[model samples]
Target: MDRSFEIQCPPFDLELSRWDTVFPHWGRSFPPSHARRIHCFSLGRNADKESLVGHLHVAFHHTVQRVPFLAGSIVPSLEGGNHQRKVVPQGVARLDIRDLSHKLSFDRLAEEGFSQHLLAEVLCSTEDNTPHVCLFEANFIDRGLLLVVSISHIVADGRGVTEMIKIFAQNLCKAQAGLIGYPLETTQEVYRSDRRRIVTGNGVPGPVEAHPALTSAAAGTHSRLADVGTCCRTYRIGADALVALKKAASSAANNSWISTNDAISAFIWRSIMVARHRAGFLDAGNEVHVAQPVDCRALLGLEEPYFGNAIYMTQGSLPFADLAGAATGLSAAARIIRAQIRTATAERFRDVVGCSERAEQEPHTRMKIADDVLAGGIILTSHFKFGLHQVDFGPAFEGRHVKALRFPVRGTMVGAVIVLPRLPDGSCEFMITEQGRTVECLVDDVFCRFTAETKTAKSVLPPSPTSPSRNGQAEFVFPESTSVKESTALNMTTLQAPHTGTIKIIEMNRPKAKNAISLQMLRQLHDEVERIHGENTTGGTRVLILASALDDVFCAGADLKQRSVMSDAQVEEFLALLRETTCKLAQLPIPTIAAVAGAALGGGLELALCCHLRVFSSTAVVGLPETKLGIIPGAGGTYRLPRIVGISHARDVILTGRRVEAQEAFAMGLCNRLVSHDSSGTERGRALQAAIELATDICGGAPLAVRAATGALSLASPAGEEAAYASLLHTTDRLEGLSSFGEKRAAVFVGE
Candidate 1:
């Protein structure tokens, strides 16, 4: 039983160092921690664990056309000789981690592999362990998906190196029994038992006598991905600098019990409160959350080493109005944070999470998190003591390589408060983002009050004290970085399908007559029909999609009320164009599809019959309803209606002039597909996207094959009347279709 024989591939076992040798730039972009974990995985494709590490270079597909700051996905590593590493539409690499973690629900893992997008993002942010790591969010959209990777490099290097990531996935998958994994990096029993760590003022000592395993890095380097920024200025007060700064921070908060974190959170909160007040959102609720990281390592006991980070957050939420009151200062805000910390026990965390399942008949009022929920908020987090600064990369430089990597990530609407600790002094550093100047003033007040005596406080955005600033200015405007490049990728789409050159969309813009066509409308449509017939690359025209604006209703059907205003010659001209347009559309070289989103009655229903297939939405109402005005359908309706929905049903509806709903129209064969429309234009846009995607698939085939299929679908009445079709039988479209279809699957059409 040679287990080595079970190795997936030669590339799968390339070992971490092999990547540094094979791909020249692998070592440059990624830190050793990241490179070591993924280098063993397959690089060219998803062969094994090695590729998972190597796959970090794959870029993301972004549907958000507006964001200029972020790359949609991945920090690509491939350069130089590897042409295959270029961005191409293909399959993705997979991961073996979380092979059924109860927390991450990825049962769909068998269907698609662990998204290369997800694992690589975790790797990128896990690089450093000092900076605080923000939460990552992923959004799924109609076009594609948007993934956000936010983390503080203070936790780990830009590359998060974990034993779970470094080992080959296939090797672990084959290891089987728990005996082989005796020293599991994380265990459920240990995590469950240590869920409640103490909140002592002083940090506890390492696990020595009580337990061995718990003390061995239960908390490892911080591992999260975010683009981080820091704003810090050091201040000195004579010799005892540390003691004095702590005194000012605590004194501003006016609480002997409050730690430096509470004071910082309070300061950041007050700044935001003033900013919100000036932004004209004075009446709206402006609640901000200040989140502090909580480590449960000591609870796991002295035996644990800081192996992999296991933590949660303590959040304090305060309203902006509370800070805006003239008497309320940093001390008042700090008191609130102190109260929140007092209430924030492990039991409270469990209770809040448990409340949902244990509610007493409360109505579930949660919006869908996918498209709507989790959209807007203000969140603050700190990773001050995550020990990420200790990351050593075997002397790459005279100093450390990675630093904090985090940025204020925007949601539908979200602001941020970020904090990091300066070394030696241990005082906190902060970065804040909000919308207004009132908040900026409060932030200035907090800073001036804390470091007032002798510390030099500078700002990337300095307040204009000497300059004549606006008196009690209500708004604070941050300069926006404007650099938007329009994408030319859209124009590259070529429209060359069998039905492309044939389909013409006609919009009647007459507002007065409820958009009903009079003599002029008939003439315009008639001329366009002729142009379509002349230019159609197919031997004849195929489809015509007609629409109108009642400029409110689709059409009121006919202008019969104004018929007496016209002479007989004028009447003849109008009837001729209507008949010509209808006949031309029906005699198209292939099948046509009519889409009705509103009313289709009388002349409208008569015109609709020109198409071979009709699709109507639930909003559409269809009928002949013309004879009520004591006249029959004028356009080729009398004959074409019978040819379409059958003579029996046609006579019943046309004679009685009864209107039918969209679903009824489908049942009677007057409509082919039934679609529902939302106010969002989602259903309609999806149809267009589907159409274009289908067109893209068809365009991949030879253009001639589609043209010949158009020939076969033509509505020639009899065998003797197929002379034009006979000539096309000898064309290149026929030869390509015969050759391609004979090979099975699809016929590659080449329009010759």
Candidate 2:
């Protein structure tokens, strides 16, 4: 029942078009060694194993019969014209089943993570000496079955493989329903493998312009594995970070509006530039290129389920200063990428096709690529919405549920970045193969800010020795302040202002109770809000930051000990005051940011939610755990939670009363940014510093305009909004903005 052997494919010869022949070896040895595209499915235990394997076998047989080209080997074209290769009927595939139920389990494998050796066992290598175009390995283990399908890039692209799987799963579904040899003609979607549709471009009238994508030194060839000292590392970007990145990038691009892919690509490109600079792999004046593969199926009007490589390359470049500069660099990089993608029109693709045709005819006429690409620049491939994550196996084992899906890239060239499919939480995982030293340099705080999985990065460390403990008796460590800063202390809170800026900080310091919201703390917080409001009328404050003095705790929600001693009447009064305080906090005339370093539960989370922006440390955990206490969030949590992370997520968090990790919190839009801990500061201090940096960025804008925008965002009435806008029209700052734009310089604005 469990043995490894070849399953011979039926006989058939198929003709290939110019598109197929244009590729090296007709795409048979696409990447030389690692050409197989594999998808692993985890089928849980309790399914009928024999029935599942039998159904798959029958389904695959019918699949190969329908898509006969997949079951044929690429051979020299018998016509012997310009065509280089044709698919010949041969032993083109193998199917193997192995049972390791006693030796392994799905849970254990997951616990250890997927290693190369483990993946090899689950999905056998397609590098066998035999010229099989496809390979299937079914590994039976405890708690599930590991079904792996490896298809050669020779016959199909990633999309084509998905289509083939769709057909195969349909066949399996039919077999599962007790129907044998169901009519293939009944299939709703037909398979189309004619590469000629995309190769319609005859030849350019004159010499084709060299594309930036193919201007490298190697020119149409990938960097040799032996030439670059490359290493692979995987990183995950949370959804919140993605949102923030897209927003910032769009703002810097003057609101041109870029997609998440563009934003992340820009970020990755800039991060690489920084890493390369640190590793001494880049020069100050060097121009770095980013090559992206654009799928041409939709561009060329191809039908659904079309097979073959319908992808063309588009690339962009920027000087090191513009690409990796401290200010607006990511936005600049994103704009360049967006411009390049816009240029990849149908006409441009036809030109590329024409050039490819000529290259196929004349070996010396092949396109060349920029030397910077292979010499440490990035080649990012996005599989964001490829449908690879949702591959279904159809009713054989009840339903197809994939616990995890990984596309391993082995032996790829340096600066190779593959954006994998999104996880269930909407976070993205990227597999980057880059120079060893450059990869090492990527683990810094500057890069880790946008990444969720930074454990491998040295910048994300544990709490420093100076951080506060759970007992709350340790000395509080606040972020560094200038000597000219002024401080005002209330009972349980402190208000501080830097020497220059009008940005103010309200630090909660009830260290004995982990900065929990007590009656006195609430009263003091209300008094500070009133004080800040009066000062703001005279243009004294531009931004306000909410933070806790304690490092290990932002706030532990309500003080349980105090609440336990309170009567129902006292609790209701406390809730009323808490609600009023939060309302005032949210209605602040200036931007407010909460710097949360540790736990923010129930009322604590609700308090942070009142801010315009929330900055969380890597060690932070947040939740609305009132449901666990047989109560619902009372202090604006019910209303604001839904508005922030959506009703579904709000319900899941508040109703279930489960704590969310920092990454998950960010992914749910509970936090604006997640800062990592560095060796120079404590975790809480780092979060506070990040918040201050954000405040400083906001402070650079005209004060009145910033306040107006903040008011509009906080749900100002339409009339109020109009009045606010009209009030700013005659201000000196408005005149300065216009003059600066006309003069091509940054506007300098005073409070006016």
Candidate 3:
């Protein structure tokens, strides 16, 4: 019989009326069944107490056995045969891996059937190999089954082997009887210096324990406690989209270094945020975390998959402070997270991950350091898929194949851990969220109505601002020389032109943290706009220019650091002020220009697009980069970027959460003009000059004509923009521009 994704069941605790059962018997150290096994396992132990174990540094993949059963084994349809109930060999797929995580995820712990393929990958075959993984393969037919199942000898004993098949059988037994199995606990070991294990041939004995890596690893960030999170979803992705996702991530990152793990983790974290938004917890402010797996092979110099929980989880947290205001900050947060992750994929961290058992290796103590992990929320991991596809059933039984499933059966999670098959398109699927109305809203506004009955806990959501310059919470100056002065005095209502011909420059400066915009800036900007409009002397400010300081950054987007400290009242104040700014920008009487040189992110970009002209330097960069922080564009980025760049490109940037360089910014028309860098009035200075030119140019026209032109260009859709753009449509260069965009080439046109 073909064994597929059938249900499994085990014992349950009925007393509490809740199945969040904890099986404390599953210890971390095992009584060795084989001397060779213990010797091999001991060879790769790491010395570091603070670093995560190097679980993935080892490789045991070479031991795979692909066994294929005749099509007749599952169905007589694949073979030319009539239906006769004669016994055929049950194909067996033995999984062998050096990693305990992959083994546990893949092993049939309660029944029979596991793969040894993991063992080959985790173990060493030659001197070049680390040699820790164990492999045993079985042949089914054209497919070979690799057995790489692992359970630390400390917990289940060799009975662990029996437990897998037994669990499978039990599940088969339960599913046959109609039930879902509860999860079995693995363990958590705390770190202490007293109770340590000693090894021979060591310079000094390993400490009984060291302090938890909490303070050192986390620094200012709070370390999350691990908890079981569960979700269920089925998804499919196209190949081209998958490639684009990686390319975009690589291009957006500094040095363009991309990895599969970071991209997947970012994707999963955002998915959880979407789910949290759906669960009527939209206003609850807390950091979202994910437990990422690290292989310890390289760190310990091991060659095979060791039979234990050799994995250590990494934290991916983007607090509400960053994401609560403008949804665009999510992507920036993700980029930071991606960078942190990029640094963590080293052999040293891997060694730290594998060293979990060093202090408690005395053979009978529980894992003490993992308590926090057991308590924290959410996990993102991958159970390599290639090996699973090749598992085989023995000829004596029937056809059987296996895919991945989560640990913590019947998961109880703030965010669940997910492992997915690598898709044909090269992207990975993640069960970060179960199907829920709340999750739907996070991914799409169409689903926002699902939580209509629930009141948000925090009402002061920051407005979305995509331009980095607009949300400057702190000050970072892009090196440029201009007559621009940043003033805290320019509050809301400060910039209304007294004369219609004047071009006003509003500089929002709260310079200390990094020139990130804040709610206060939003209010100030808004009030100044109103101030200009109310003016009689310098009346009808025909053009406006928004610029930042002059040292390093041009508004690093929203002020997440400040927003994190706000209470409900303050948050609302923040949101209110922000909304006023967007509204004012839309209503401005004359043209607007956003001048930039450096990072114009999330809110910064949002504000830039509101202007009639977005002028930038070749050194400047622009993007939404917010979803990584667990949010979408809050201001008008969702509506604006799509309207400007078309829905397709916007979706690509938003979903992938990638940043683009200055050249790319111009190519996408995210900037109206790309200028050169210089101390003698840089791109930003040119922007101010350009605004004056536009104002003078427009002043020459009938005021009525200019106002009408300005009015239509400010609409939210392309249908409206198309009409306004039509006025420029008559120009020869405009035709070239449109043609060039369509043809994927540069435009060449003579001035009309």
Candidate 4:
């Protein structure tokens, strides 16, 4: 049996908070995206269907009077798009009640766990185009009642939904007890006024620019919604197991403090990675990043009753090797996750608001994560702290209240994890929705092992004799050490300065790892270039050629393995050094050329772009693929690439993190020359030889005249360059060029 009706709303109009304004735009691409909360309520013995329906209608109507926004229609901001969208009372709320007593039993639902039959009845499709809150109730004969509430994410977030439910339940219980004139803790006037103050004071914070990884992941998930079916499964962790898990996490972290949420989240994240790896979705070099939506109401100093979208999406990442290493690896992963979460402090929220205000002047395309491109990661949304079970309908059903809360599984939400409230037995449930065999593997392999190992305190006690246990921590024997002969670090880079030539060469010599730049190599290169500048007293080196001594690659990028082990402060220092070195190279007196032989990525590409010209081999590929790893090109790529290649082109390359081959790079003006392999069947060093030949031809010109012309051309386009270089006339390089031109007899360049 099925019946549908509309609950009349109380007349009112409520202005939205600044936070509410961003959701409509954030979800513009995915119109069907909304908050679908399925709350299972145990009504003890079956109540009369007609009586229950009447009671619900009365409760909903009264609740709407107290919180009119629930029954309001979301209207576009009438302030001409200057503020957040507003909500006006529509005088009606859609309510649907369905009886599944004949078709399915409630016990069957519990045994099977979230049946598609019930799911199909509750889930909303984008085609429905319903903008208002939808209430769906499925009554099970002699079993219980299932309440499914679907609210447009734009109308309210999880907190708002919780608030509405609490009020509705309170009103229903009061009406059931024949009470009259119940006192309300909060009214529409008070809520609206408070929201107005917060909005006016802080202004609406805009969405952050989407990283390429996020956009790629989102697109992939959206497109593959059909091919990869979506399913949700709930994993329950008992209270004792939670304690043991927290202990394990803290032990792995060397006694570091680990919250229950962090410990559980870390365990789940690692388990998912292991599952993905077993399913062949992950590789050794691939990194997994996790995005967690953090509630920022407390950080923003908002009161408890305020209902809006007050959240920040924070992220953390780790290499597969490190995360899947030893048992203690969970602690290391937890540390990273905790650090990222700590960034969502009050100060950071204020800064985000400031950025949003500044962004209003220049709008940009918002970014989103693509599902297929996420490199095996998860996005977790937690309602564990929302006290969902505490939402009592009345004393009549006190013993038999909410047993479980499950969110609707959307196909586009693959790899999404929902952390629900603890059950009556003090066990928490995790509802993970994903595609492919990932969830199956997670349940069959990881969760089973974890449950077996933590079944009892004695089960995991004493640890393994072979591995041993140390002070609450497990110790496993590491692999045998592989020893290699030490090599001189200074030889990683070599400088070839001829006694008398107009060209100098700097060659990268770390061939074993494709000449990936290490901190030591970078320092050596910087020192050698500074030394060359000091020694060139006559400014005679008209061209500096940079090439790789390796066979197949110019430079793979920075030494990520080395960087992975560094602290945050150390990483900052390393990036600063790299940026400074590249800036100096770009500002050198003589023109520089980068001879690219193979792959140039991340810092390698940034370094190559800093040079005045780049010559690529036929097999070479170049790109700034940092966003794939959840980071941006930090060493001047964001700024320099836009200047070199127009903003649109740079945005496309940087945002997509796609590699450009030699032909494409040259066509896009990313490379000055594209040299083919030698016909003599030798490709090694072919690009370098061509670059040297190009430098030699350039050296044939008057040295002082070349230097002056290069400097003048650099200052010709940008404004204020003239004033910045007004002292160029007093330089001996400028005067010598004038004198040499007048003499016209190939005037000998002097050691001025």
Q: Model 2: which ten-residue window has the lowest total lDDT?
A: 480-489
Count clashing residue pairs per candidate: 80, 7, 208, 17
TM-score of candidate 4 relative to the true fold: 0.55
How high is the CA lDDT of each candidate model? 0.39, 0.67, 0.41, 0.63
Ranking by lDDT: 2, 4, 3, 1
Better of 2 and 4 by lDDT: 2
User: Compared with the true structure, what per-residue lDDT tens digits does model 2 show for residues 226-278?
Assistant: 56555666677766556656665664437676788898888788787767765
Residue 543, candidate 3: alpha-carbon lDDT: 64
Q: Residue 332 deviation, candidate 4, in Å?
A: 1.9
lDDT of 1 at 309: 30
TM-score of each: 0.31, 0.57, 0.32, 0.55
Cα deviation at 33, candidate 1, in Å, is: 99
Off by over 4 Å in 2: 4-13, 24-35, 78-83, 101-104, 112-124, 128-130, 180-194, 205-208, 215-224, 360-370, 395-399, 454-752
Every candidate's CA RMSD: 29.1, 20.4, 22.5, 20.3
* Overall local distance difference test of candidate 4: 0.63
Task: Please report, as a residue range, the 10-residue window in candidate 1 with the lowest summed lDDT.
Answer: 481-490
lDDT leader: 2
Best candidate (score: TM-score): 2
Q: Residue 120 in model 3: shift from native, Å?
A: 32
Question: Candidate 1 clash total?
Answer: 80
lDDT of 4 by residue, 1-752 (tens): 46776655555546565546653354233323456667655554545667666666667667766766666676667663443467676645666777766655455555545443355563443333556754545444336566777666666677777877788788878767767333322233533443545643255444454322222122334455445555556666656666666666675326567687887788778777766665457786777777776778887778777666666666778887777765555777787777778877765555454443443453432224334323467777677778878777865452536756776555335667777876555556777766444554453342443432211221222122123356654332222110011112223232322323457777776654577777656766777677666655354466888877666777888888658756697688788889888888877767788989888889889989888888899989889999999999988999889888879889999999999889988888888888875675444477877887777766655454455556666667554355435645565645766788898855444433
